[model samples]
Target: MKMFMLKSLCLAAIMLIAVLTGMQLASSGIQKMKGYEDPNLETAVSFHEKDNNVKASILGNDISSHNIAAKKKKLEEISAFNFFSSMGKKLSNGITSASEKLIQFIAD
Candidate 1:
């Protein structure tokens, strides 16, 4: 049972690492795609000026601000989770190393 649990834990760690790596890769890819500056700023502004609705614009800005706040909170949560996960990984590695050393000493 202990061995099974260890195997399961290791599998979970591997899966987590893979998922994090994939997310990093995907984010980097998106960043790369965003390297170019938007070339239609004047055109966009002209279009917006043509159909300017004050109330709707204010509502849209409010919604955008809310979305930004939500995304910021989610980013913070993800950062905290990442920190804890990394600490756990380091602790597990230290324990594993200490156990292996103790086993070697006992054998000798």
Candidate 2:
């Protein structure tokens, strides 16, 4: 029990050190890349700024919530077939059938 505890403690300490080292290396690498990146090449507005602008533009337009819901309903109606759900059903059926066959074989 003592040996197991010592090994587990050592493993935890090693993992902690590894994680801290990885974080330090990643941060230093990011800083190094930032120094090489050109200021002129950078975007005037950050990604969050651009995202906010898009959201504001969308809200500013004379689009109603009812219209958006109607559009969504139309799209859903157009693609009535759900490929993933059908695939999942087929996969589960196949697995169940295979397991039953394996159990029958083992019993016999």
Query: Residue-wise lDDT of candidate 1 within 1-108, one digit each (tens)?
Result: 999999999999999868756765665566567795444311111113335542213212333456779999999888755788899999999999999999999999
Instruction: Give the clash count for model 1.
Output: 0
Candidate 2 lDDT, 1-108, residue by residue in tens: 999999999999999868756765665576677887544442222223354443212212433457789999999889878899999999999999999999999999
Lowest lDDT block of 10, candidate 2: 54-63
lDDT of 1 at 29: 67
- Clashing pairs for predicted structure model 1, backbone only: none
* Model 2 TM: 0.33
TM-score of each: 0.33, 0.33
Error (Å) of candidate 2 at residue 21 is 0.4
Against the true structure, candidate 1 reaches a TM-score of 0.33
